[model samples]
Target: MQNNKSAARQYVCKRRSDKMKITVRVKPNAKKDHIEAEREGEYIAQIKAAPAEGKANNALIKLLAAHFDIARSRIKIISGFSSRNKIIEIIYTRKQ
Candidate 1:
């Protein structure tokens, strides 16, 4: 039998983590901005921004922030700032 009170408590008190890392393959100049896929330890992100003047990088951060349901300031690109494949770090997040 389902205990309504216990289920409600669990749902209301979900665990939240402070940080996480994500490996992302960014596709710049795509028709639209979206997440293409997710693998064992990586994610594929597609954005409409061109890969120039840090535009694509910025777009990737925004896309990731939205995807993870976090603020833009909480997302940081940890590596591969100059390549299509990048590693992102998300801090102070609550994932359900």
Candidate 2:
């Protein structure tokens, strides 16, 4: 058994240093709506609201904020507001 502790530590450290931006695919107005986490996972979310009048987009922001335990103001819709796919930018400072 060789020790690879240092290598593992570095990888974990780098991940923490990076602020994660997740891309989600929205499926609106399905039968009994739900959210599913992908295996290659990037915050895949589903909503019951239709993609109209910015309703689904608003719902997405609220759901993500609640799930991540962050303020709604922190998550912004960077792009794809009208499309099914969206990019969300989550900003946070490094933990002390």
lDDT against the true structure, each candidate: 0.73, 0.67
Candidate 1, lDDT over the whole model: 0.73
TM-score for each of the candidates: 0.75, 0.70
Q: Candidate 1's residue-wise lDDT over 36-72, tens digit each?
A: 4454446678889999999999998888778767889
**Residue 32 shift from truth in candidate 1, angstroms:** 0.2
lDDT of 1 at 19: 69
lDDT of model 1 at position 60? 89
RMSD of 2: 9.0
Q: Write down the TM-score for model 2.
A: 0.70
Candidate 2 stretches greater than 4 Å from native:
1-18, 31-33, 93-96
Candidate 2 on 1-96: residue-level lDDT in tens?
A: 122223221111112343556667788886644555553324457787888999999888888877777888878887788988777776566567
